[model samples]
Target: MTDVSTSDETQVDVETASESESSSYDAAQRRSRQIEADLAGDAGRYRMLTGDRPTGRLHIGHYFGSLANRVRLQELGVDSWIVIADYQVITDRDGVGPIRERVLSLLVDYLAVGLDPARSTIFTHSAVPALNQLMLPFLSLVTDSELRRNPTVKSELAASQRPMSGLMLTYPVHQAADILFCKANVVPVGKDQLPHLEQTRVVARRFDETYGRGSLKAPVFPQPDALLSEAPNILGTDGTKMSKSRGNTIEIGMTADATAKIIKRAVTDSDRNITYDPQGRPEVANLLLLAALCTGRTPQSWADEIGDGGAGRLKAVVTEAVNSTFAPIRERRAELEADPGHLLRVLAEGNARANAVAEATLDEVREAMGMAYDLA
Candidate 1:
């Protein structure tokens, strides 16, 4: 019954695989360190451009994922451009009508979250039509296969179980335009969004290699580097990715009782005792994460405190933390929403500022491609 073999070949193979993984991990660490050094050295010199789709009100996942980084960068005096991707809403939902209110809501959220218009240029994608003109040249740099291979697009299509529209397929190119138009040198993204940023880099590089190589030593468009957020992603109540489409998301400015109700209803394991087992108890861990992020404490510490009472106590803490932190934000959002005209004026001024940058960049692109016959 004792038939066990430990051959040299198997041992060598195992060692080889382990060494390979170790080498890759080392390389990644080195890269991360380099980026940290570079940002620390001259962070204000960097121009950041990041934003959200105005499909719905921003949620907890949106806040923790990248929004917090945006605030930090703005405070550090990095020239930032916050875009509202209005066109993107129709890429998936063509039937959605009257997005103006949603756009206003998103703007209010941005303001409520301390995204100062004085420091950041907040504008809608539709306002900067010149940015779209850059997309044609950018699209020529990318291929149909590459677009289809984009993980973000592939995942969305898979989830929808529908053939992707051309607009949906070329959304990455549109993203490239968004980055390049503003001459954004940095973009804050998550692990999943790295591919999209890479595609933008490729397009920028290809354009430079093809056109800018002759006149300009480097590309006219800077290949934007990612400023990956250190904050952990927040999950939905049901242990899935928080999403607006699924109605599983807790909008940041929801009433305190509503927030508590949603947290109370969040799924957790049958175990009466609480422990920080992410794999075994994802839902409970998520609640703990929410509390920890809101309170600046450790998830395990929260789990340890809620040892006997189970998920209910954890939910209560998370609810209180979130509401307490977001109380001022909600009040600001309400104040802004009450005076919609004042919000529009702010957006209008931002649009003018964005258009100035976008048009200047477009003029450069047209000149680079020898399409600007009117250039004097």
Candidate 2:
């Protein structure tokens, strides 16, 4: 008998090499398909669903993340829906009073930021009862163990010492309900959210396989592909995630003086030559990035313009840029705030349109699942 034994080191190297090759191949295939889809303009066949959780007033991070994308999508003539995710807020925080106010403030922010209510439907999660109802049937399709394995749920659980509630545990399922109810074919998502999109696709596939007939639309749901943005991640003044809780956010509603003060107090390195070194001087780089975004100038240009004056000149230029960018938004927000009734009317009209679409989707869902007779 011939003995052919490999050492553990060699075996490990072989496995690692195989995995890397496989990952590269898969990524290449995904890229090819994405390019094909883009060239074909297949996005036209799809409706888009994207939103924020409305945990607090909108920040620059929110603007960069999905809000700006939403505005562009709306302009592109894609059927778009922006949900103020009021329900999801409960998963992370307590008390609805603050959230309710925050939710309305978010609407004002959205309007001020140029989300035309005419072009896009802006509504709340709680207003869509049919959409919420779909959660029940969708939940039955997946296992508890599967929910536990979701990376987002796991991360949230790890962040806190408190026990995870049922709402928090199955938050992804609720998200699926949100997308599937709209039958949205494209969901603009960040890289971190790919897992949730995958899970939504799974629920759609399961529903089609289990109950869909040939006469009914097979897999009526489209596995939404991500529309990645080119915007840089705007960091908080403290160099953390730009959040209201951190007190580092430049609120869209702030006056010019307030905005200037925040920029002046923004964190930066002690020995700053105003270079854009995110790794070595994240705080300084972040400020520069904000200034660039506001002024419509490249960060490199800003760096050149403010060279060698240290943090003081950086602060001055940044404050000027930020004040200039937000001046219009502040004026518009104040105008909208003056007439609270107009905001309510916008929500009411949006709710009606959203309800009509959601109810139509729910009817089809019920018919597919043989529940139409029960409803009749």
Model 1 segments more than 4 A misplaced? 1-32, 156-162, 216-218
Show the colliding residue pairs in model 2. none
lDDT of 1 at 293: 88
Q: Tens-digit lDDT track for model 1 on 1-376?
A: 2233457667888999779756744554455456667776677788889888887788988888777778878887788899999988788776556689889988998888889998999999998889988888888988889998898788878888677788899999999998999889888775567778889989999988888876655578888877665768688988898998778888978998899888888888888798887888788888888889889999999888888986677777888999998898899988988998989998998999999999999888777787878836
Number of clashes found in candidate 2: 0
Query: lDDT score of model 1?
Result: 0.84
Model 2, span 1-376: residue lDDT tens: 1233457667888999779756744564475357336634654565788887877777766776667777777766777888889889888667565876787898898899888998778899999899898888899999998898798899888997889989999899999988888788777765567678778989988888877754385765666565544558888888888888789998888888988788888888878578888788888888888888877788888888788989999999888888887788889999998988999999898888889988888888888887787633
| Angstrom error at residue 9, model 1 | 22
Give per-model TM-scores: 0.89, 0.89
> Which runs in model 2 stand beyond 4 Å of their true positions?
1-44, 214-217, 374-376
lDDT for position 181 in model 1: 92
lDDT of 2 at 161: 85
What is the Cα-based lDDT of residue 58 in candidate 1? 88
